[model samples]
Target: MTHQVHLGIALERAGWHPAAWREPSAHARALTSPAYWRDLLRTADDAGLALATIEDALSLPDRFEPVDALRPGRVRGRLDAVLIASYAAPLTRRIGLIPTVTTTHTEPFHVATGIQTLDFASRGRAGVRLVAGASAAERANFGRRDIGVDVFPASGRVEDSPEILAAFREAGEFADVLARLWDSWQDDAIIRDLESGRFLDADRVHRIEFEGEFFSITGASIVPRSPQGRPLLTVLAHQTVPFRLAAEHADLVYVTPHDDADVVAIRDDLDAAADDLRRDREPLRVFADLLVLVEDTAVAARDASQRLDEWAGEPLTSDARVVVGTPADVVDAVRELAASGVDGVRLRPARQPADVVAIAEKVAPILRSAGVLREDADGASLRTRLGLTRPESRYVGEKVAL
Candidate 1:
């Protein structure tokens, strides 16, 4: 049987299109408010989507030129992604809350503890989308050395400067240490024996003595083992270095493939990387990311996207595939990609609430009828719902075969 097509929504404030904030349906000013996020997440929960990815950056959205900062109808600013996910966790029951955290400037120790807390808050439904790269402006905010985005090429081929490679290398190490820290506390470490007056087993908790080019850590995380041994680690990979990093660390990886041919090629690259991985783990779940504009019909959706671009005063662009169609058309496009071995697609709704609602009501049914989607809220953890097993801690030794 074909694998089920998993679904996730990329919850960008004001939606994917820049002009979406100007749309009547968009509450532009409420993008940072907790109430706004609760409502949006509730929509996903009510619709039974598999996951929701909240986007973030160290810097505000702006143009290269300073004057363009004041451009009207262009959305700008966002709340902290991790905080947003934490705020939404209680309001929604099942959708996985994966928030983007930049590995470039943030410390690994902080990232480890933060996501672990999010997992506890969400009861194992938390995932982290590790991002790399900090613009000069963003670096200025943190008083750190600037890491230029130019090192990452548009063609997905790696011809990077030492600085660029170092940035990705650091990101890879950050991901590695995060996993170790999460598993530093063995699942059986916490023992509440009132008579003995001992709460934890010292031997069960081990130090993660990790040393890398950019980071060095000896950690036994303060938090206990999260519900998912390791909250799902994921990365968005476009080039060789990032692909290798994703293959080495991520449980699920997101990619931007324009068509079936693109999907096949990228999947081949990722498969090769995974096959050569130093560690033994399950094959990576590769999800293609897309910007979707689903309206009453395909033509209307295209027209709407065109209008959004016109309003923004330039052609709207994105790293992911952009699909303009009705819910049925969107399903067809997803099916086409799935036939070429794509595990699933994470959609960035061109307009939020409405487009996402349409996906739940229309596209989900089509997928469910075809056995491409699981029935609503059927799993205990995000890992289970995605058909991933709860991984044993890396510190634990493998069982000896009989």
Candidate 2:
């Protein structure tokens, strides 16, 4: 294949629009409402998107250095991502519904079980987006003991650099342990044998007693092995070391390519990591994420961009690298990113349903003509559509290479 592409949408809380709640199409009710998420997933699935992520996030008040901005505190958001996906599961057929769950506060036991439930409810189409936040406001929602800022390594950490390298190592190890916990149960352990009056095969289950500097999680899961063995594990990484996590673990990795040139660097780095880790499994699927406002004309898109910036409390700065252009221009950017060695993209719409639908109608056709989209996208389960194999039912055996 020349390239592979999968479309995914993250239902960001209110989607970067302060006035989104006031908009007619925007949900005025709870974001946690089943109906609201169901509609969004249905729309995205109908439009050929592969995944619709119901991302749960505890928003830290947007820290403002200036005196006049909205003071930092807990912002508006309250929804459990895993539960939302579970509820949305029976509502959609083809689209994979992965929800965000933080490893920061959530236990591997609970998180692993939740994803397994999602896989069952959706008939094996569930994935999890794992994110770790270091903000005090977000930590407040967890309400355990206080996890000070130093608990997580500071940003810009390097081997010989300023930030605490140990902290990054700790967090990375925790994530690895979380993934292992998700697989602790053997697939066949959950044999429902009413005839024999026996419930499960205990010997098949493995207990993991992983003890690390930052954490020490013990043994087998309360839930049976998931249908997917492990649902698609996705992680977002902005820098080099973080990207290494994706290289070793993630089925999908989302990164922002600074330019066409940057795509090469990201791909090369990931490839090197895979080789270093000796992971000769599937080919790595790297995807570029861009916030975009597509319009009939470049100027029209620019106008929409400016409006969003105004809502963001300032003109959009260089910090958020968003694509603002006509469909043709946006197509060019996507094509370039794909050529720079990526499987696909997770396009962030600058606006609401309009931009999303517009991209599907306009930009997608261009990609189709370019032959980047996969042919198997039609008439397949999310796994089959992604060109991934259907895993053995949660009652199988495996060899673990230590």
Candidate 3:
């Protein structure tokens, strides 16, 4: 297959737009249904998309707080992202399944093994999106420690307060621990030698003594080496700390750039951060996140967006760029971002199934025609597909070549 732009879809309950559920095609009550998630993954797989991210949080949807007194068609609840991915893994093929998880209140040991389990479940087509918790309500759900939202700044910069910097620093260390734990067991550790009566080589497993200001752990992960060796690490970031975290650990990062200049700036920052850290791994794959309202024609797409906005009684905006256009127009917009060195685009559909179908049936064909999308997944692991090598176990001593 020729070189092409990567494509992933961020799947949330109902859709991204607050008013999306008001759309005729929205499944307002199917947010927690296993069948709903399964069908969604199947649809994405059929489209030959690279991956799909299941959005999750520690708490209920804060957008609809006081859940009983919510809007008519708002999505209220969410199933566990990790569980959803695992449930749908066997039911789908090709597309990678990435679940969002908050690293703040969760254990790195649990995060490592959980994602490793996902990689096994999905046959190496698994990843996790690490997000730092930024809500007081979310903290209450954990009750683990007091992580105030004030720790994160309004500017998304780290140079301001020690608390914010500490949070990011903790996040960075957390990511490091996850990676180390993932490599704690060597690939050939599982001997399964019946004659020797050894299921694994004890020496192959190493302990990871990770001690940080926020969290500490001493032990290797309970889960064995997964199919991917180390599953892909992903983060969505808009600023320096997160960008640095992504550069240091993430195989892929989702960024939202407002314009070509923003794209250039973000890419430059990523490169600089990687260089500053002396990261020798492959360049981080940067995918732009866009909220897309796609239809057969640009006019229709605009109408759709406006109608959704009308339902919400206000104009809609987002942290990510929101594009309302035909499938071809959407492709053009993505190509423009790609020109600015973006590796791919992760489309957040404004409405489920309908907008997703537009992406798969319409936008994907256009990308394929332009030699920018592969016709099939080619049975490659998600990390392989993303051009990442199977990472060597850090626990293993380096073998010297004669």
| Residue-level lDDT tens digits of model 3 in 251-307 | 899999989889989988998999987357888889999999888877788898889
Per-model C-alpha lDDT, please?
Answer: 0.82, 0.66, 0.82
Across residues 77-157, which tens digit of lDDT does each residue of candidate 1 receive? 789999999888877899999999988889989989999999999998999999876556566668767455533355545
Against the hidden reference, what TM-scores do the models get? 0.93, 0.84, 0.93
Residue 29 of model 2 has an lDDT of 64
TM-score of 2: 0.84
- Per-residue lDDT of candidate 2, residues 215-326 (tens digit): 7877676776666777887877766676776777677778887786677787778878778763765765666887776789988777766666655566554323577898
Per-model RMSD to reference? 3.4, 4.1, 3.4
Which stretches of candidate 2 lie above 4 Å from their native place?
A: 1-4, 17-32, 60-75, 143-147, 150-167, 317-320, 377-381, 389-402
User: How large an RMSD does model 1 have?
Assistant: 3.4
Q: Return the TM-score for candidate 1, rounded to 2 decimals.
A: 0.93
lDDT, candidate 2, at 302: 74
Cα-lDDT of candidate 2:
0.66
